[model samples]
Target: MLNKVFHLTENHTTVKTECIAGVTTFMTMAYILAVNPNILSAAGMDPTAVLLATCLASFLGTMCMGMMANLPFALSAGMGLNAFFAYTVVGNMGYPWQVALLAVLVEGVIFLVLSLTNVREALFNVIPISLKQAVSVGIGVYIAFIGLQNAGVVVNNDSTLVSLVSFTDHFRTSGICALLAIIGIFLTAVLYLKHVKGSILIGILGTWILGILCQLTGLYQVDAEAGYNSLIPTFAMTDFSKLGETFGQCFRVDFDGISIVNFIVVIFSFLFVDIFDTLGTLVGVCTKADMLDKDGKFAKIKPALLADSIATSAGAILGTSTTTTFVESSAGVAVGGRTGLTAVVTAVLFLVSMLFAPIFIAIPSFATAPALVIVGFLMFTTITEIKFSEKDYVKAIPAYLCILAMPLFYSISEGISIGVISYTLLHLICGRGKEVKPLMYILTVLFILKYIFL
Candidate 1:
């Protein structure tokens, strides 16, 4: 059954190798389990509950990806989307945690409906290639930003226009450590390009050892108090009867406040970001794995989309934020995860990590920072696929904008928003609007107006 489903023979990867890939992928991504709860707890949800929900949703979602999408990628509460939930929805928008969860639920249901129907595939077809590349670059920058911040390389500057680097004090230590990591990643990439086996796993382990060395030598300190604890699935007993009540109270949307304008804006924000994020992840991973169909669509995208939407809705009910497909799955793809075996491996590893959450949590973010930065560099390779030419400004400008805006705007959704808006406006002005599909035009305009004005 594994052979038939996973195509292990066709891919020339043994169960042993696939299992190793799966384990490596899990370790590389296990940071989400710790980090997501930290971010969401600050938004007022029960930290323990969020942890359980994240684990279960990640397992279920990745399992679906294995059985249905037959791709090696795994799904989880995405880094960017969760930040939006915590910071933007709960912190800035003044919504309660439960209400934010409800919004996630609504978005999930909509995603599920679209996925089960043909609309999901239709929408995937219309997205411009440039925008897809933009998402890749944006995610890269965002991941890099995460690494720098976690390493304490960048910090808030009180007097400057924005935060600046902590150049004076921690420079020598953090700089040397980060440099070692970067060198490790580069060596791994070179080996990978040369077709060396297990290069990624080796590179990651090497970088981790360097971090441990830094800690032991007093160059860095490990926070031993932040130990890991096992995650037990407990949301099965939560009184979902209050789901509606909890949601309503959290959002505080009175009938008088629910104008057509606000409702449309909220809906558009949720839909546009989720759709494009999923689309870009799918395209980027598919491109890396050579899984794109001749028509430039992922053949099994429907199930993948359904899995993502279901994961997000499940996360909401379990008390968390929007769950989406992670761009980091490209890491697995880059290392030869071409079949469901890869995803199944990833899922099994996530399930096991639940048993050792404490150990998983114990590893400092700096330890994982190397993997994040490394994956960012790997995904950044997609930029080479973009065509650069005098006549290509229409595509190039928006793409470049998206690449740059992700880190600057500090939000993948915002970067995508700007990219789509730029793409649509440019195409229209250049008399090339007919080249873009009608649905894309409509969605692009709606995203721009909703995000910008409303």
Candidate 2:
């Protein structure tokens, strides 16, 4: 039955290999179970509720990917999109969390429509290879920057904009996040370099144990008042009362003046990022699994993308951010995952996470920071495939801008917008206007109008 369903024998894989790959994939991306709730908590939502929502969405989305698309990809609340929902939409823009969720729902519905049509599939031709590679690199840099900030290796400076930690004062402090981060990075890197499977998971566990030992030995003191403490794992912090309040919040979008504009921009940003992110993950992971056809196209990509879109919408309704295909799925492919059974096993693990919310939430920022950094390194590997050696600086310049602008602007949409617009203008200037697609022209105009009017 398993072979009939997942074609395990035909794909040169076994049930044991698929199961191991699924567990490995879950271990690599399980940090999201902790990170998403922590980030979304800033939006005034309950952390425990976000935890439940994250796991639930991941389980459902990944199950769909397995049953419908028969792909070995896991879906979860995306990191950058969650940060945008919290810091930009709810924090800076002053929109209610409910309305922000509404924007995610709208974006997901639009994505679903596009996926159902042939329009989304045709995007492979519309977007240039250089820009696709650039987008992946941009996301890599962005995730790494986020990891550094989360680990306290990077901090904000009023004058310099950003600065590294000063070990003089930092070492004097009992709770030294920088030290733990360095240790985590070193450990994870060493393990990965040695070809150890589940290196990220092992690193997180090792760091957590080290933190607890430091606390117990009085090397790292807990300052409860300052909210600084040792990384002790426990099941005492989960709170589910607010879960009821956030349910069905997607129906609460405001139709007022500023809100209307905010709604449009937020949805557009989520939709744009999710589309490219899923496309990149599908292409990269499937290529590694040898699931791509002779044309370099992913098999059953439409259903996979649709599953992602539906997961995003489901996540919004369940009180979280955008749920999309995780780049970390490549971790499973690396471990010989080549069938939907891998995803099925992963979905079951996610479902089990719902009962262990406090254990998941007990993971500290310093422990998981290394995983993000390492994953960023994996994604940035695509930079080698980009064509940048030619004298046609037009193509290379836009690609470089896309890579740099993301972390600089702290927004994925801005980087993509600038890259696409620059690609259009440079091509037109170089008498290569015919290469630009009608949809690209439309997107260029939409981005321009968004900048000027909203």
In TM-score terms, which candidate is top? 2
lDDT string, candidate 1, 1-454, tens digits? 7888777898777776776666667767777888887888888766666776777778888888888877787888887678878887668767656656667777888888888887878877666776776677677777767766664445567786346454445444555544555566576667677877666767666666666676557655433353312221222333224334333233453444334554445555666678877876776667656676666666788888888888877767766677788776766766667777878888877776666666666554545566667677777777887778979988999899888888887766677778878888899999998887788788787776665675
Off by over 4 Å in 2: 1-4, 8-21, 24-28, 38-44, 83-96, 172-175, 224-230, 236-242, 249-273, 276-296, 330-338
Count residue pairs with overlapping backbones in model 2. 0
lDDT of each: 0.70, 0.79
lDDT of 1: 0.70
Best of the candidates, lDDT: 2
- By TM-score, how accurate is candidate 2? 0.84
Residue pairs in clash, model 1: 228-358, 229-358
Clash-forming residue pairs, model 2: none
**Model 2 lDDT vs. the true structure?**
0.79
Task: Mark the 10 consecutive residues where model 1 has the least summed lDDT.
Answer: 227-236
